[model samples]
Target chain A: MTTIQNRQILLAKRPAGMPTEENFSFVETAVPKLQAGQLLVNTLYLSVDPYMRGRMNDRKTYVPPYALNEMITGGVVGQVEESLAEGFVPGDIVLGNFGWALYNVAAAASVKKVNPDLAPISTALGVLGMPGLTAYYGLLDIGQPKEGETVVVSGAAGAVGMLVGQIAKIKGARAVGIAGSDEKINYLVEELGFDAAVNYKKGDLRQQLKEACPSGVDIYFDNVGGTVSDAVLSLINKGTRIPLCGRISLYNLEQADIGPRIQTQLLINSALMQGFIVSNYAEQAEEGLNQMAQWLKEGKINYTETITEGFDNIPKAFLGLFCGENTGKQLIKIADPAR
Target chain B: MTTIQNRQILLAKRPAGMPTEENFSFVETAVPKLQAGQLLVNTLYLSVDPYMRGRMNDRKTYVPPYALNEMITGGVVGQVEESLAEGFVPGDIVLGNFGWALYNVAAAASVKKVNPDLAPISTALGVLGMPGLTAYYGLLDIGQPKEGETVVVSGAAGAVGMLVGQIAKIKGARAVGIAGSDEKINYLVEELGFDAAVNYKKGDLRQQLKEACPSGVDIYFDNVGGTVSDAVLSLINKGTRIPLCGRISLYNLEQADIGPRIQTQLLINSALMQGFIVSNYAEQAEEGLNQMAQWLKEGKINYTETITEGFDNIPKAFLGLFCGENTGKQLIKIADPAR
Candidate 1:
């Protein structure tokens, strides 16, 4: 066993609104020799998700808020540098909810081994990981997209939204995407095979959405809420289903943002709107991962990642999520496997 | 075939914000000779519900908006004077979606027979009628109040809401009601056996709700939307369920009421908020009706009616729902059963 120097990022303070660089701090620490039943894993890829912004705030959401000065914890794909328990391996790839550090020391059972032969190891933090399962359960279980129905996804180019649109297509539903940039809109329509993609940045989102979905939206997989959601709602058909995955648009606001009360619209339409987090389906993780992997194998689904290299870029990559900067899964490349 | 004089009400014009007497017009007409498969129903009790206010608007909802110059149609309990249908009857109590008139001529098959001995005949339009069924399916089917959970119901004094609170109690759940008046607060707690009652009209709804529901709200049966809903949402427990039955507060607003968006609140809680109308469970209507009837017979549920006497008072009864003037089901009594 050997002690290794680690570089980590910490939540310096709770953000007032849109977070700046000052909200995060960098530190150098030493990882002690692995204890019994623990594995020493060197970080390879660290996920910087929009949900992390929620954790930074000192408020209890689906998960506990991140502690001040503590290393931020998130999805990490890394190679085991040393092991002391169970299926012993020196160069095995694994995934776990670990720290935003160059290296992590965790219980051997706390992480799951990732097959290097399946796909890129980085996918364990992206399309094949938490985002994948989130898209699977949130869309299939809640959205329940039926054939010939139109499914509209906000944040269509983001990690979860893009997968939701593709899954909607796999269910034989018309996938229409609502995104902020023309680049993302094109990527959704041309690359991901979305039936149509609307650039919400252009004014008259209602008119654009109406044109894109002439039959009206049957399911709205919402990752970005606020005015974008309001416009999509205006065109929702009777019996519409809204899978409220995230509200990246309103996450950073210092004060609460107000919009039209949705109850009347929901009542008149006889619609269903449900909010969910990925861990809500923890018991069914294997089912979602297997199905998603099968879809990727059959060429029925695709994925993308905006990787920022270096250990210090995690906070910048995370803040980029709110500005609609990243196209798909935003990740940081910390190190490479020594295999 | 004797022609019988009748007093019918028509939608004179669509309401702008709040409906007034002028928006409705009384038209003297005659009951035509009964056609084959038709029954002559002498209106005994006409239901004036908050949902009727939606029909007064020109916009399309779950049901089409009532067209100007057309007779207002809703739930009516009446005595069948003559029938040319297969189920021939000279004097039989029945229920149908009929005109707001002294007598209604309708296809006999379109109406269902009401068992007067099961309870009171008027209950066919109150506790055991559309309002009853609305509360039944909306609460049980959507809210799914599990035992020991706390259910907070807004518009607790109204037709659907009072039953919702009682049904929550019947399920062994804690029922907390939000009503406008102290009188209704007393009725909810004392008469209906609610665990607690908050008078929203007295203000400090958040504090009252916190005190009333120390366990936090597991289910919310929303009949009145706007600020009342916003307050209830603030105290929702994880995995909370919201059954959006009606938004009486927003029904008459000329301008859309803006409030704090709820997507974040819902997402963090992994909650479900579904909007529903009674007819959505048309296939299961018998199941719901049978269950509700059983509860009523066992005295597990109690109901009250604020009766407005005379045919001309129908509009006043309907209008009173907005001002919280009535308790339980607001009803208009036009006549006694001819039988």
Candidate 2:
């Protein structure tokens, strides 16, 4: 029987503080034969998200930590190379929580088939997928931005942050984005039509944010927590809503992030602050996807992805997230299935 | 012309930390004549609450700070001595936001008439007043404690805290109280039917809290924000609701409280923390007061008051709140209107 080589990345060591390339190890193994109800999938695009950094630590979070020397699992868009399961045929485009491998043998039930004609297949990993649903539910359900309200989003150039700002605008609220780079700030304001964008890495963050949100922040969709959040919390209006999506700033920190305790701030303004993960609204995912897809069709929404070429570059692309390297969803293109 | 001598308490100086008797100044002023739409009111019962501490500071809060040398104004039960206003008549009992004095000249529109026969007139300052409405709206609206959930209350022996625990029991939730003294804890568990009560000043707070709330805290009515809140937050269950009412413990602090940042805790559990004032539900205050009155009539609710006699004792009654010297609602019986 002929055997195919599977190139996979495993967590070699748990990260301390900021993660380095040495934390991951690349291995080659023979692609195993598919058992009953299993399909052989060739990974076309693999996603690298900030949340995955939390899984690298030996701690309990919403999701379990990735075990050492094991294949790191995340969102992957793949093509069925062979199928021993019903309803899935070879050449079918699919999305699954699969291992960081060039080739994956997964249970048919574990992967869902994606329609190639809907939009770019990679979006199943971004705007129309987990990242997209995260932005949708966290902003709309938790933040609850109302018309004429100022909606400030931290980490505004990232996958979820970018969408949160745009959705705030679509809902008739002013969108103010806080990004790290001037280019990301410009992209947010000029391209995504954000009302205002502030480069947190440059200039006075508190002054820029105060100037941007003259009406005071009514809704804050927090994708990056830490000092940026502290500044935003200072300018919150009465009845302000804050949806705690991700604390990307604290994800890689070795020590506990101390604070100007926010309890007083919340108390003074009678505000609401809530923390949530995307799966918190899993029951409404389908509805979110359909609405997002319609918005995409109507030109009411736009998306961007930074695709790094080659499977070997996944670790490098992920490390860039901490340094604010990507403008949108950061994905690794392993191979072109059609080619 | 008959001149009435009005004895009053004024904020002498902003308290550096915990307030002292020196922070208040006793003054005697001649009562000014009532205006066209005003009435002359004789103070009967004056409320001394933890929230009053916030108004003593020069800092801007939900309520404006009490100015130095100006008569301190708060909730007062009074008898209309004379009236030039349409809705008010002489000899009628009323409630108003009036000066902490023996006599006050107030606009008739600023004060509402209280039925003398409906329970004791003092109930208007305790269980059927601001404290009652605070517990009703904050617990039911913000806390949203469902049946069978573990509801924890910090400052559970105080005015609003005691009512919050009783209302939680009425909603079929397990009520746990955190008090400063063993006597207060016993009162909460024994007299109030609280499922459990912990003396935060005694024993290991975290361990005691963990033992008290074995099912984890689903709802935390936080009247005291500081280390006590931090402990309760640590044991919060998924979807925990925290109503930020008051922070008596931190009220006297000269510096801002730092933390184990609670953003991560809220995020991980998908919990909600909301800060609200009773007036936020002013549109429904009537509904809340009526419901609380019905609860009292049914003997489903009970209340306690630490009443210090004599008008001269107002400052002392107010100062005792910080040390947990008073149980339930702390009030100063300035005078008996019938006497």
Candidate 3:
């Protein structure tokens, strides 16, 4: 018989501005025994995405908001430590929505075991996972990039943006990436084969973008919506498609305030701007992942992750995304090398 | 041979706010005989739509703005008094982009001869024409309303809104029309088969919309985009489709003004709001007109035209739309029957 245990990181309080070390309390207890049709998993890596910011608000959303004093939940890659399910056993690595904890006992249907021979296990949280699918579908399906068209992607050095720029190249569209730093810009253009990369922190973004895309923008994959999106809207051609993935700039602000007004321009140009959440498109995830995994295997796609060393550092890694501190996908390595 | 009369209305001045008699001037000239492949049409009914207000501005648009001291051009229904073209003959009713005038020579290709035996000639300027086709394609193709869902349409008793509400009903969806006057509301419900109609001038808008559409809005056909559209956005369901046909409320306002802020709610509900002009979909105009014609013959669709007495009153009718004075499709009857 397996012993029961509780290992978790509970939210100490709703973060006021930026989350600190005091916000997370990591605790350990007996390992929980699995029930019928359930499996016990030992956490390998936990994903940290910017969308998790909305969940902490305790407001109404497409999904339920995370409760105070509860464990923060997100996508996880873990090894099946024990199994009470029919098809799984010890040593099978699975990918699912396990949270910020050491061990998880979940219903069998909630997790999918990974094929490590096909791709690396960490890819289940990065290039072969939700972020990868988001880039693939949001660009191809919603952005609808045509050959020789100019594409502008905001958050160009992040997990989704890097892949989007590369995919635009594959589709014969010119990819222009917008990021926050010189290193990220160099990586996006020199390494990822982006046609151009603009550091938005620099002055005169509109002038820079005008110089980069003389023909004007056609497909814009908007990950960071604020002044960057506002500037890009002016450069967009008639019938341009803007796939709105995230609005990282507006996430922290709590009041009904206006920043950039785009509706007047949106109307004049007849551009199509659409907002999409990755999880809502789960039905197409398998198709997206299969294509992304193939690209990963063939060395056609690349990804980078800023790995935080402990379960206690999950909040730090998440908050780092807003400050432009993380280079690509951000993940937390929760487990120490031990049984 | 019919006399070629050069009759036109010129833009006298750019208006500061609402256009007045001082903004327009009428002139009549000696008739010049028609050239080969040209048809001379005696203008019967002249269309004065809200979009004509857009053409008055010096700014560039999908179509160029009306130049000062030039004839203001729009859709018209006329009787062909003379024809040098093979297809068009004398005594035939025709429709074309005939300017605000009494008699004009039109190119054979640009004018379509209307068969009065099939439908009323006035319909060629109203329900079976641009406004009908606009409402048909924008609602069904863009909005894509489903059965039992609530649809909210602004400018509820006007040409496009009247047709959109009827089209919504035909699709098995509940149509909630928003207009300014109680008379328009009564007409919308009693004549057009709207499920509900809201008089924005009378009561609390948001509360009334909530009461009318307790289930939340599914499709929003926005012809007037100021306060009414802002109110509708608050009551939209997740995945709601908005076909933004016009923003008549903001047409005259020059400055960046404040109204309702809706972007956060737009992200929260995962709704889509897209702007469109009818001329972009002109390729399908024949198909839309054919379907609309059949519906018109079956008594399934109805429209009203507020007929002004003369061509000189065109500015008054156009300005009345902004003041919420016109009851239905505003038309200027230029020809005197008694003469």
Instruction: For each candidate, give its TM-score against the true structure.
Output: 0.98, 0.98, 0.95
In model 3, the runs with Cα more than 4 Å from the true position are: A1-6, A16-23, A257-261, A336-339, B1-5, B257-263, B336-339
* Residue B84 error, candidate 3, Å: 1.7
Each candidate's interface RMSD, rounded to one decimal?
0.8, 0.8, 2.3
Candidate 2 error regions (>4 Å): none
List, residue by residue over A40-109, the lDDT tens digit for candidate 3. 8889889988888778776776567788888888899988877899999888888889768888888889
Ranking by DockQ: 1, 2, 3
Q: Compose the digit string of candidate 2's lDDT tens values, residues A5-112.
A: 889999999989999999999999999988999999999999999989989989877889999999999999999999999999999999999999999999999998
Q: Write the per-residue lDDT of candidate 2 for residues B1-339, one digit (tens) a residue.
A: 599998999999999998998999999999998789999999999998888899999988888899999999899999999999997888899999999999999999899999987789988999999999999999999998799999999989999999999999999999999999999999999999999999999989989999988899999999999989999999998889999999998999988799888998898889999999998999999999999999999999989999999988888888889989999999989889863
Clashing pairs in 3: A4-A30, A4-A31, A5-A30, A5-A31, A5-A32, B4-B31, B4-B32
Clashes of 1: 0
Ranking by lDDT: 2, 1, 3
Q: Considering summed lDDT, which 10 consecutive residues are worst modelled in model 1 chain B? A: B330-339
Candidate 2 overall Cα lDDT vs. reference? 0.93
Cα-based lDDT at residue B224, candidate 3: 84
> Chain B alone: TM-score in each candidate?
0.98, 0.98, 0.95
